[model samples]
Target: MVLVFLMVNAYRELTPIVISGRTIPLKTIRKAVFIFCFALTLILISIFLILFNQGNESSFLKVLFEVTSAFGTVGLTTGIAPHLSTFAGLVIILIMFIGRVGPLTMMVSFGFRKTRAIPQYPEEDIAVG
Candidate 1:
């Protein structure tokens, strides 16, 4: 699943840090976030197209709004739920689950826990406004 993929990726990237006490690569985190965001965008687009093509009398904007609302776990509706087909209702339920347990939280929960050792590096303060 998605969580497995994230754990593999995180383990590969964080192994050095966990074993050698090195910092995680920022670029790795950036790339992971970018990919996740792209996937989420694609899912939204697919939902929009399907809803719009249904010709169920709901406006495209309304469909988008409902999809977002469901995905965000926000119960607001533009008065279109009663007409949605069974499949669409199922999609909404899936979205609600995704919203409730954010993708990142679920993914990160798959990682193995690390134990801390005594600190070796001294703390230094950098000037900040």
Candidate 2:
């Protein structure tokens, strides 16, 4: 979240979220809020959908907690870990993989963009006094 704020504020050179050709302009605060909220909603929705299909009778909050645990790569569980279906286990594994690798991947992707180009201007630097 802090990094997202830095990206939206300090790192003004990078585009926030570009899809196809539609570049919706968003300010630093708005972009941060949007990203945070959207990601939370999406994660909750995916978790709920998967658990629902697995015929769960648990409340949404319980499922959300489980989903957060998986995403956070935490070992804690509400006694539901062993009973999950194979598909659900696989999904959790995949989420765990993402939780482990996602930040590294994000850094790499942020380092390289399809629209980036070599600087056309000459470089100059100030000397330390």
> CA lDDT, every prediction?
0.67, 0.64
TM-score of each: 0.51, 0.52
Candidate 1 segments whose C-alpha is farther than 4 A from its true place? 1-32, 35-39, 42-46, 106-129
Q: Candidate 1: worst 10 consecutive residues by lDDT?
A: 14-23
**Could you tell me which residue pairs clash in candidate 2?**
none
Tell me the tens digit of each residue's lDDT in model 1 across 32-127: 666578448745864775575567667778877887787777789988888787777777776677667876655567757587897799889687
Pairs with steric clashes in candidate 1: none
lDDT of 1 at 41: 78
For 42-108, candidate 2 gives per-residue lDDT tens digits of 5766686767767855556666777778877777677676777777777777667666666345445
Residue 72 lDDT in model 2?
76
